[model samples]
Every structure is written in structure tokens, then in C-alpha cells.
Target: MTDAPRTLADAREWARVGTELVLGAVADIGDGEFDADSMLPGWTRKHLAAHVAANADALCNLVHWAATGEETPMYASAEERAAGIAKGPAMSAQELRAWLCASAVKLARGLDGLTAEQWRNKVVTAQGRTVPATELPWMRSREVCVHAADFGTGVSFSDLPAGFLTALVDEIAAKRGLTELPDGPLPEVAAWLAGRPHALADAPELGPWL
Candidate 1:
């Protein structure tokens, strides 16, 4: 099995890299391009950008939950989550970029304040799975990397780390009950499994992925 990120530090660094990549890709986009449809069906680059920022804030809530031993839900409700995504396109490109960057910084700061013991505290994800606070970085890393690709800008699966691609493929395969995937480069296979376009002709059809 491919080894996952072992330490909180490693996960944090990976998350940092992922965030930088996403920001870099969106840095030059204009308002119209940001509002255009992204690779994700029905979501504009604006929606994707908004979701990324909101996800950071939501994960920050998890960090708060871990540090304070308080129950802080990722979002108030599913409707709130949808509403937040819907609200992304309303911002100007500059505002959207600022929001995304600021939220990411805020989340990092929140995480940095956690004590060693707090890192082991349990927090519930938006999906309702209980996990250690240390898991937040990996969770955030996956979000930024994949959603950056969903932006359909120059960023593609090939731009991601090889290890991340392998781990992502394993995670997607397990989640989707997909045992046999088309043979190809790790990035292409991972992208295909995640419902992204890839060069492989015989890639299996997949439903929505997280």
C-alpha cells in the first residue's frame, strides 16, 4: 500500500504546496473566466474558488473543535454548504482571490495554535466521519489539489505530486468500489477515477467523487 502522510508537519507542508498551486493557477484569471464553467459539471470557476475558501473556514472549525473540546460543525447544514458555494460567483475576481488566500492563512493559523495533545483530539468532518485533528491538513491538501484541477485552467493532474496521485487513486478506488482501473500513468488513472478527463480510452465510468 502507498504510504500516507505520516506526520502533521508533512501534511501541513503538502497542504501548503497544494494551496500555492491553486492560487497560482487562478492568479491571472479575469472575472469572466472565473465565472465560466469549470471542469466540474454545473460549477463555474467562481463556484470552485468559493468552495475552496469555504472549505478552509469549515476545516478551521474542526481545528477549533479539537483545540477547545467544543462541538463545532463544519457547516450549519447541507443547505448552508450549498448556499456558500452558490455565493462564490457573486464576488469580483480580486475579492474571490483575496477570500481564498485569507481563508487558507486563517486555517493555517488555527492549526498552528493547537497543542500536541489537541492534535489528537477528535473532530467530525463535514461528511460526519470522526477523525483526529491532524487529519485536517491531508483533507485540505486533497481539496486544493483536486479542485485546482477542476478549475480547468492550465493546472492538470500531471502537475500534482506523484505520491498524491497514487494515494488519491487508492482513496477514490476504495470509495467508489472500483477494483479494476484502466492501466496508464498514475496521474491519468487518478484523474479518470476522480471523474476528470484523461487520455486513457478505456477508463471506467465513475460517479461523483468527493
Candidate 2:
């Protein structure tokens, strides 16, 4: 059977862990490393950093929409989102780090302050999927955790929580075909789901999910 959808509280805990993992990896970035290529093709570490930071701010819009009944969209438009990511690397490494951490904190606070009713408010993702506010934590958790590994630091699917990994693989697999769990442990399945190198030599080399 498919795994049950994660609860808001449980998903928020996953996001918290993932945010810390990303912050730790960012903390380890040395000079020149920001410009260094990441596991994601043609993207430097700074690109990943910028996207992660902007995502927090973008996601905050949905949190606000849920909290206030405001019609806040994740970004003004798709072009605006592209422009923001394009300009992200222009910031100094220190400035970028602060922006990422602060945005993450702000998003966390927004989620923490929501009432039960607020949590049930409907919001649309940047991808145009309509979902309840409860999905916010799961969305953010996916971003931080996946990008942490994408940064090409020590973090990998194996480093993530088993519950999250299992869910991630299941989610990605759903997109590929709404398929069932592949025969493997959560981590290996995650690596395959993430299109990263794994022990599954037969795994297909899927391109970037985004």
C-alpha cells in the first residue's frame, strides 16, 4: 500500500531537520566554493543557495495566504521567479548565507503561528497544484533536503530521515508513473528517485526533476 500522507506537525519536524542540514552544509562553504560547480549540471553552489533561499521567501507567501485569507501567490509571475534565481548569485557569499538563514527562520515562524483552522486553508503552489496549507511543511522539507544533497557536500539520501526518504521516493515515483516502491531500502530508492548515483546500476539516469 502507498504510504499515508504525512501530518502537518510531522512534516514540519522533517522540514526543521532538513533546514538545519542545509544550513550546516552552507556553513561549510569556503571561499571559491560558492562558484564551484554543484551536482546539478551547470549550476554552481551559489545557484543552489539562491534557489533554496528564494524558495523560502516564495513559500512564505502561501503561509501568509493561509494565515490571513490573503490571495498571496508564491511569486508575482513565473518570469519574476526566474529573474530572482538568475540574480541570486550576485550576492556576496556572506550576504547570501544570511538571506537564506533569515528567510528560513521567517518561514518557520509563519508556520508555527498558524492556527488549526489556518492550517486547513487552501493555497496553490507555484506549480499550480491546489493543496491545503498543511502541505507547506512537506513542500519546504523537500526543497531543503533535496538541495542539501545536490550541493555535493557530504549530505546524501542516506543522510536523510527514513520516513522522509521513503516519502520522497514515493512522490517522485508518482510523478514518473505513480509507481510503487522500487525494490530497495529507502535511501537507495531515494538516490534513484533523485536521479543521483546509487548502487542500482540498472537505474535510469533521469534528468533534473525540476
Candidate 3:
């Protein structure tokens, strides 16, 4: 994406686009399909949907921290996070799908309620990096978009908006300590950084960036 969303307005809009894309895929899923393996190893479609819903809940914690100046973490512990995901398989298909939709709506409402000053408040990410609250939208944007593709129902890297993909590629490139975008087309570079399949045979092995 030549003009990847950097502004707060853009980020919010793009995040919504990502949410819609993924949820549409979710909507089309037959009950039997939830047990199928997703693009992510060892995770079924149900687990993927569960994680995405839980992620919105986690981000809402950050939004609370930013809004109130309290020190709330995304997850109390990694085990707690895993335990949240572990709850998915036990849920009925309707229950899990409703949870996914509601969580996303709740998170979006929470974010929209913040004032400009609150948006600038410093907050710590799950990775322990302190960034302005503005980054939350971007974080959410990345989550829904990448995971949208991971479902492998129909949405894919190429299905994502170019600007959003470009932004994701640039952010992941910097994380890998590269000053320049990886040598490939936008979708390929984004796919590579996202730990998905890419056509770049020359790409180096990378640890998880999510």
C-alpha cells in the first residue's frame, strides 16, 4: 500500500475493513468447517476465531489503561492468554461466532470513546515496548487483517488493501532491522513478514513477528 494508514482516522477505518473481511469469512463457515485446520499450524478455524475475539478483549484492557492512566496489561500472563484460547473448542459454534462479533464491536466502541489527549497517552504493549495509544488502532488493524487471511476460507494476502499491506510490511521490516522493504512485491513481502507462504524463495527464515 503506497499510502498505508498512518493517521488515526485511517487506522480506524482500515481496522474496520479488516474486521469486516474476517467476519465475512467467519459468517460463511459451515459448522463442520470450524474444526478444519487454519493456515496457522496446530490451530483450527475455531481456535483462530477465538483468538481474534480474545485479542479484542485484550486490546480493550490497553484502551482502559490509556483512558484512565491505570496500569492494565493486555494479558495477566501468557498462560492466562493460552487458557483463554483453550476455551474455544468447548464453545458451541453459535456461541463462538457471537463472541467474535461482540468483542470486535466492544473494542471499536471503546476506542471511539477516547479523546485526543487519551490517544496520546503512553502505554506498554504485550512485548513491553511503550508506545502512544495511537498504536493500538494499528495493532488491531494488523491483527484482523493477518488473521483474516490465516482462516484460509477465501480471504488472502492479495485480498488485503494495498496500503494496509504496505504498512504491515514496513512495520515488520523495521522489526527485522531492515531499513528498506524486503525484496519482493507488496503481497509477497507482507506474506513473508507475516510468517505465511510467499513466492520469495530467497527469503530468510524468520521467527514469529505476531
TM-scores, all candidates, are 0.94, 0.95, 0.92
Candidate 2 residue lDDT tens string, 1-210 = 256776777788889999999999988988578888888888888888889999999999999999999999999999988877777678788988998899999999999999999999999999899999999999999999888888888998888887787678778888887455557667887877777767765666776675
Model 3 segments more than 4 A misplaced: 1-5, 179-183
**Candidate 2 Cα errors over 4 Å, as ranges:** 178-182
Candidate that beats the other on lDDT, 1 or 2, i.e. the better one = 1
- Which stretch of 10 consecutive residues in model 2 shows the poorest summed lDDT? 177-186
lDDT of 1 by residue, 1-210 (tens): 254645677677768888998899789677678888888898899999999999999998898999999999999999999998999878889989999999999999998899999999999998889999989998998999888888877898898887677778878888887777777888889888888888988666777776
| Candidate number of the best TM-score | 2
**lDDT for model 2:** 0.86
Top candidate on lDDT is 3
Residue 92's lDDT within candidate 1 is 88
Candidate 2 Cα deviation (angstroms), residue 95: 0.6
lDDT values, one for every candidate: 0.87, 0.86, 0.87
- Rank by lDDT, highest first: 3, 1, 2
TM-score-better candidate, 2 vs 3: 2
Worst 10 residues of 3 by lDDT: 1-10
Better TM-score candidate (1, 3): 1
Model 2 CA lDDT for position 1: 22
Candidate 1 lDDT score at position 22: 88
- Candidate 2, number of clashes: 0
Clashing pairs in 1: none
lDDT of 1 at 50: 91
